[model samples]
Target: MAKLDFHIVNRIRAQVARLGDRAALRHQAAGQWLDISWREFGAQIHQLALALAGQGLKVQDKVAIFSNNMPRWTIADFATLYNRCVTVPIYPTNTPQQAAYILNDADVRVLFVGEQAQHDAALALADDCPQLERIVVMDESVVLADHPLVCHYRDFIDTYAPQADVAVLARRLDEIRMDDLLTLIYTSGTTGTPKGVMLDYANVASQIESHDQKLALDEGDTSLCFLPLSHVFERAWTFYVLHRGGINCYLSDTNQLKTALPAVKPNVMAAVPRVYEKIYSAVHDKVSRAPLHRKVMFTWAVNMGARMALARQECRPPSWLLQKSYNLADKLVLSKLRDLLGGNIKFMPCGGAKLDESIGRFFHAIGINVKLGYGMTETTATVSCWDDQCFNPDSIGMPMPGAEVKIGENNEILVRGPMVMRGYYNMPEETAKNFTADGFLKTGDAGHFDEHGNLFITDRIKELMKTSGGKYIAPQVIEGAIGKDHFIEQIAVIADTRKFVSALIVPCFETLEAHARELNIKYQDRLELIKHTQIIELIEKRVVELQKDLARFEQVKKFTLLPKAFSMDQGELTPTQKLRRKVIQDRYHQQIEEMYEESHKRSPRPH
Candidate 1:
């Protein structure tokens, strides 16, 4: 007897009602304060949902939505849920083919588009998808395509919206159940056509509950959200913030994070490692440009912190002098570094990649409590997270409350709990193959749990590669080295039936200039710089230096720096900005082959 709990949504509804005139949403539109209260926020969704119901839409129907983090985007999402339909959020930058695959496979009958580009992508998809019958644009674009059914966002809601029937609405609300499907989040589709991971209402609700229990704060807490809503981590976290009755301000877009961060000074925020990496690089780059004395002082303090950061408390000597020295360094150097992450930051819940321990330690040394977590799209967002008080620099965190975790024979992380998704939509084969007979989801990530229940993600099962020398090297380690160099943007290692390992690299043009200047060289465009023998030798020399720390097997023997890096426009990088090794390997097969071509000519490479 599964039934609609409405625990989360009802709690938010009550808070909005109580908050009344208090501003619940804020956006800086054209230097003007565009704000809305809880009442208006709830009313827009109410109207949007009622209008959707009036369109003869049935419960559990798929409603696809595409947009950045706008107030209306959130409204459309909750409205779709209140109307008892599945919310299929599409990424704004997704290719038309990827968008078309999701719409057709999910059987999305109604679409809520964002703007001109989104509408054009939908229009391109319309001819291929038979189920899509309506197109509604979210922006103020008056232009309409030649589709048989097209309407502006406002007109569509007004057309299908019903006058509030209090009794019917309540009854409709009652009919909803917790186990009912609430969302179908499509994978980034970097590996293949995106498969929709269908999450139940209870799945989402339980995650919010877990989050509220773990990361509760006083009322009046604020968050600035910029991640794509199509991702479950961002979407679920947003609802949890509303559940906390926290004031949330949506950033204009990813491109506007700098302009938005200072404007909406939030107390709490969550971001992937890339954001933190950029912040770290900015601080380091700026410091390198300071006076010789200041640069030396900064470097000395940072190095002291780095040394202490990688050590466990048990490893520290019982000397107060060393501790005092570290404390002083933290005060002088580390504190300034953390202040860059918005000094008001209570916790930066970083995830979506393996964070460099160095980066984590640099922030921690300065009194900034940067907590790291681990999870996936299939687990309904978060399964393990490092809390502020109880955290380990080396481990991701303990398994989430009541979430059962076990290691498979193959070392794959397996999770069995209410937080796991029902199954992939229209993917019986994938669903069946991806699970155990008892229904535990088999996470393809390789990991292990210590006696204290702390989890350590080791490597990805699908990404492990072996060289022709029969020595295995984790590509991430090599890739991490490449990433550490400022000039390197995106890189993928090649591991085939070959004698040695090689890499395809894309240089960061902005950073490349400074790197070239350091070496007293000149270059024009990206292509010219990458192909220059001197610049190539500089990167190769760095690679040799880095490989000195690695084993002979782990060393990148030969490398080809590409003119362009993986872009979202290309199918090579995930929307989260993770490297798609397989796609890159496929794209640059010839370049990889050249690395081994002159290997015999190697002047006895250093291990």
Candidate 2:
């Protein structure tokens, strides 16, 4: 049932041949939509490959792409593979030091930079990375005249002979094998140093094949590409979209998503949980401030939509009256939610971290399919995702076709399939430690399967906390439970080697401010506002109510209200909005220590 049997290059070539004049990819420039036809895409890739070859790129030479999501990123990626070169992707949010480490580790020779930031990062690493010879800048706005090593993307491609034959590129494509190394994706390194996950042509091809079997995306579909292309989830998902001959809309600025979504009206998209969480919060906050009648109407519509959704999932038709209710619900409320994501979104894939069940259900209740998925960089982005008919908000769904998933020792999720990466590039010991003897990659995530075979992730194995009382706690579970509160924007649970659980909380400033205004409470700034007793009591009450499902020991006993939220720029969050636990702990050591101190003083134990 695999949709693809050939390698990625051939697959893309086939798409170009079959859908020659169609818009294969689209991006906005100078406030206008521009489309690149399949034929043009193919030609650009060919020219870029030859230009790379002219610059002395050889088989297996590492080519680094440090860029935001754009059409040129994919063109450069496929062109590298066309020349039998390895593509090493560096996240756009990565600091210059991080970029230097990857470039030096991968020994990248030619780096394709997207904009001024990435180009500057590459230039900063010039002295450190001896192998890096040329810099191809994608953004034409960047001005670099005196530099001999740097050139605009168009100018770089023009350097190659125009008469270069397509037959030679065809011969090279024929030489490619399924097992040949294709890309090196570095881990986000929340815990420690980043390691490059080695993936081959077979790994990517197999994922596209398996993924197509699970999801029914077709040629007519359009996917919005906004997440960083450096992440495997977006990168691989984009590849699948291209293979299906779908139009890809690239958003260089994530801040423009709210505007872009309605403008593009994409049929499909994938994003991290933060995006949906923000959307969910915005929707609820708006409804909360609405008139009482409007609030009641919205609630009714949501309930009706949920009923209709359940009926559709069970393949049962709703009764005539219920169907009429759902129609009204869609017209009055559900359709407005859909409009936020460009009304045509058939389904949007969410991954990179655990999605709160409340947020997931809310999307479903509004007639939007937020297919919660599970995977890591090592699995080529998707190990499992919701199927066409069976959708579950609590679990990450069944394994992708041709992929095997099972619970191993410590309840860690184990995976075995062609989609799994070969190993960590140049780190044999780390790679060996990551896999079982039989070749199954040990995904460090702890999870179990339901009777219907849905995978429910509990927490990360390494992130599990052990209290001094010898009880193990899943921080993510506690975080997910309380983090969905209307007033709490972000949370991090702390319990390792401690007597009880605690949290560092970031209040939803907007909601908190509105509440403050209603209560006639005034403060100079966020610091003074979070210190207000009334605000603390409000968040505390919400936390207590939310933690009712948690066991006594697992409940957060004490918490500190942070004045600000964790951010990727501060190195406290990863590119995907996952909190960097160690970094956050280190940065807030004073606050964490104070919380434990207060707990000890409040509940002194006999020695």
Best by lDDT: 2
lDDT of 1 at 288: 65
Go through the candidates in order and give the C-alpha RMSD of each one to the true structure.
3.1, 2.7
TM-scores of all predicted structures: 0.92, 0.95
Report the Cα lDDT for residue 359, model 2. Answer: 84
lDDT of 2 by residue, 78-140 (tens): 999998899999988898889889998999988889988887877776777777788899888
439-552: candidate 1 lDDT, tens digit per residue? 788988888988777898877777788767787667876776556655566677777666887877777677777877888777777788777777777677767775576667
Stretches of candidate 2 exceeding 4 Å from the true structure = 1-5, 161-168, 599-607
- The TM-score between candidate 2 and the true structure equals 0.95
At residue 299, candidate 2 shows an lDDT of 95
Model 1 misplacement above 4 A = 1-6, 162-167, 300-335, 518-520, 547-549, 599-606
